[model samples]
Target: MSQPTDSSAWPPPAPRTPRHARRRKLRRAALTLVAAMAPWLAGSWGASRSSTCTPRTAHADPSFWEQVTQEPEEAARLERYQAEMQRGHQQASLVLGEGRQRDVEPLPPLQRRQLTQEARRAFQRAARIRPTVAEPHYYLAVFTFFALHSCAQCQFDPAIATEIVEELEAFEALSPLDPRLTSLLGDRAILYTRLSGHATPAKTREYLERAIADYRAIIARSAGLRQRWELTYGNLAEALMMIGDLEEAIATYRLAQRHASTASILLGLAVAMDRDERGVEARTLIRELGPDAVASWEEDVLRGDTFYVPQGEVHYYRALIAETRGDINGAIAAYRQFEQSNAHPQFAPRAAANRAALTRAVTRAVR
Candidate 1:
């Protein structure tokens, strides 16, 4: 899978919908015990990919809901329908809470699949009962996408993809002005981007471009939510980087930096600047971050804290900054620190190569 840059900088993520709130709560609850877990463990033990996912409810109970609930006294039926929808939301939240336990105690494949299926069933019921509301559809899309990767044995379901688009289209029609709609759009963008992981290059570019467009739209209308704006820009920069648009990525990260103060954004900007050969600029930002600040943030991450830049990535960026400034020893040391302290499988090889090349250079210089 193509890895996207880490985007976990904003703490206390913006308020979420009921289902998402529950999911976030799971992470927060796990944070207290995160220090006890392996430093490399992700915040969530994402769904297991070994098994196939089966929707808990094969199909909505057309008769039980449509006839018994809706066909009863019309006035009472509406009230009952609303109640059912609320119940559905609650059900989904309950399943999500269980899934979140993966942060504390890793879930087995069967349990993960069951939780996702149950959540989907609840959300599906809500969507059926309240066709106009966006929450059910939003959660459905999220859960489906998440399960798609987790259930590696499952075949891609075109129907689910179609459902997500149709639901999002309906949501936009229902609430054009609701601010939460922006988040939904961003979610859709991410969905497409994730799909592009196993897609053709053209498709990958197309999805990433779509994600960028959604992010840009949010930025255009972002009025009050500084946190959302920061996140959107960071996401946009990440998409840009995926497509090798280094210059734009650098520019977008700079924009994100102004909106939020976090090591992740700074590191993002530093990485982009380095890629674009703006090493001096990268060094400046890294220096501003300083060693102490990076250490504190890493400590938080090690303790299973949520909403901070990742633990070991800082060292990688610092090494790059040192290399740009011709500080061979500093660069080598930072690279070593990263290797010793963090198990970032993706960056480890590159770090080793950089270190080896620098060591060779130093040996020649001495000769």
Candidate 2:
């Protein structure tokens, strides 16, 4: 789906381990690297697009639908929407429960009020054609999870969660168990992981485990599907890292690296290396990812930077190297560089601090 550009994945320096700053940088670096690699992990959209295949961006957001209403060129989106609407059947969704049993219901209402509406309408439309199809159900579950994470005042909606789970349970009863379930389950696990919020890392790990199972099953079923299943390797790596399983995360990343090597994968490797406390090895990736990976946009996301690649992550990463060489200015400069490219709204404070600290340092030096 075409999104509002990419989010920066720069690592941050947390307060807990400021003294073990090297470890802090690398640990955070691993996560940043994994997040940065997601776009590539999803695989390029080039081959994915076919004559019938419409863009995923417009469909990614409801705005695309509204755009078609205004601008005629968005006819493709309208056509796709209409077609999907026409297929209002359960089977039309293709599968109700693709990967996991994460059919949780009732989401935080205020958080994703708009998205909930979209999901309900889309799911209802699809259910009209193939009430049996899992696509709509899976998507609805995904939407609910996303809504669950919104900043709006909300808590776990156990009932809605139960409803979605029952839907998936019914799906399991009617649908034959096979590799097809892997894809559906994988999606469900990802959704659950996203919605789990501050839940124990154990829960997140469990969700990822389900996702990983689906990915691995897909790989095992047919050799023809290896490329697609392999893509989940990065996702698995990210999940493992998030749970603080650095050892398993490294292994998972290496496995993915063996399948394909690109800037994204290399970035993953760099992150893994940072996690493993192998700063020297991590550098190899940073060099390859280049100084600026984000596409240019007008926004000064981090500082006055024109793009965002989650590069503030890079600052926390390179901080190790700067510290290792006893170069305070260089370390601070790297942090500032990351701050300039920060895009995520969540990390604004730290980014600002880095920018301000560096600015004051520069000013004092001139004095």
Candidate 3:
């Protein structure tokens, strides 16, 4: 469940569009957004975690008969399950590609669907053989989210998304302190964040709230780990910003900066400050992060980083900054740039709308 963070409470630049119309636009944009991101997210899932299937340890005081009979049978079953899981995983790897080398062209849709269905059956069979084990459920969750349900041609099905979450929850129940749990939670959070784009206003708020909660859980669980979780911190901040919790978002972004002063983090902090009515500070931060620096980071740093801002958000923020400073022409140019780039689905509509409004204003001034 999500806390109440009504986005409507934030000031709008123009008169609010009718709710239904806005929702319709968002639903369409969300589909495009998910399609663009799903392949890479699926690739990341395959690379991040290994199967959590360990063989049962030997019985400490088993009889000779038990060792000869029951133990052998159990070992055979385990072996069968592992083999089935391996086959399914290989199928998945073929579709999702290997590690960070995700530039592999996608399999044709029909072939991909056929392979994924076969993989799903393999995982399902493995689960049936070892219903108590968590590994099969984890793989099933991954496949359901990334392969089966998240195809570029598929519509966003809320029920399927809920089922995927349930599968992940089953895995969590079976393996509470699993090393991969944090990454899985992050994945779930990302799913929720994307789902919010296609959801109704109420559902959007609820999804964002859940995302915020999951991100917080990840940060808590990752305490004392050798590597810093700056990305999680930044993600959490962004979720907070979405929910209109500007104060907490600003605080969280600053905390992320302490670990890593990334361009995304700085830009997020500036946006939060601007939304919270600290425009002077926001402008200072943007000015310090000059256009040249932003371009360099966009070209170099963001491509290598897993948790950087979406591709066009930098331009969107620039548009916002320009609008605040009364540079209408500059704002329009920035918005146009953002529209041409791989903008986030949720922000894309807003940018288009704002650009339209500014264009009208400029036209009126000319008259």
Candidate 4:
């Protein structure tokens, strides 16, 4: 699925000692980062397009879709509308270009808002013209979901949220048996489960349950999508973990591993193991990643022009695990190494701060 460009792994900052104050800071940072990440519905828009894909904007005309409607054949009109939708999705990535970094400035609020509105309108018009087409509805749902986090200070609006779900439901109804429906459901599951933390307990449970069902559904329909199966399986485990079903989460990750073993899946397995109190397994998994394996994953992701790498957080978690086991020196080393090597500014600062705090605490205790 095509979508707006945004940040990756917008997790809360790693907590520091003095648990109460750190928890408050974590909550605030989490909310802010959620907006920062933009919560776009999918990965790189370019990656979503097949080699035969052509952009509507190759001619640089805003009236392209309007012109397309004049085509006599409904199939031709639908093709043009779909191309317009792709342009809209690509324009979003073009507007935001790469992602916001500490050194790079993002688009101005006014320009961003206008461009985002344009994209939304493009997606909207596509759905309006081809009311029966599932693709348009899927893009509309993506745009709506992304819009919820497109701006800073954006809060969860129940109305807008409901609209997203409705659009997804409509898409599912149109393409009940389409394999692509699995992708749309996975997007819905991810969006809802991620936001559930800030929502009510009942709401949280509802979303987690929905996500679990969708993920399972994808697994059950594994036709020719081994890759999607692994991805969805990991997500199911994450949803389970969010709801404190750690045992199931662990089992699911293991199940995913049996099908395909990638760094992203390995990270999920490691995190689940650590959270499930299997520190030894988590540590071994991290060690198995090694430097070469980590580097290769990074290179592969960069080659694909995707910025988000699940392996990036490996060393950060490694430091936390070391610290939890009371190896302050080991934790300090790991944190510093992570801060120096990682590109994500958000996590680097957290790692640096933790490293400094640990260093100070160790020094004070020695005295």
Best by lDDT: 3
**Native-structure RMSD, model 3:** 22.2
lDDT of 2: 0.48
Between prediction 2 and prediction 4, the one with superior TM-score is 4
List, residue by residue over 20-51, the lDDT tens digit for candidate 2. Answer: 44444445555655665556545447437556
Candidate 4 lDDT over residue span 12-124, tens digit each: 21122242443454465556545534423222344357666543323224454443333335544555576667666765654544254566677787877787778767877
User: Pairing residues by index, what is the TM-score of model 4?
Assistant: 0.47
lDDT of 1 at 93: 49
TM-score for all models, in order of appearance: 0.51, 0.42, 0.57, 0.47
**Number of residue pairs clashing in candidate 4, backbone atoms closer than 3 angstroms, sequence gap of 3 or more or interchain:** 0
Return the clash pairs for model 1, or none: none
Candidate 2 Cα errors over 4 Å, as ranges: 1-166, 173-179, 292-367
Q: What is the C-alpha RMSD of each candidate to the true structure, in Å?
A: 21.6, 27.0, 22.2, 23.9
- What CA RMSD would candidate 4 show? 23.9
Residue 36 of model 4 has an lDDT of 39
Per-prediction tally of clashes: 0, 38, 0, 0
lDDT values of the candidates? Answer: 0.60, 0.48, 0.69, 0.62
User: What residue pairs clash in candidate 3, if any at all?
Assistant: none
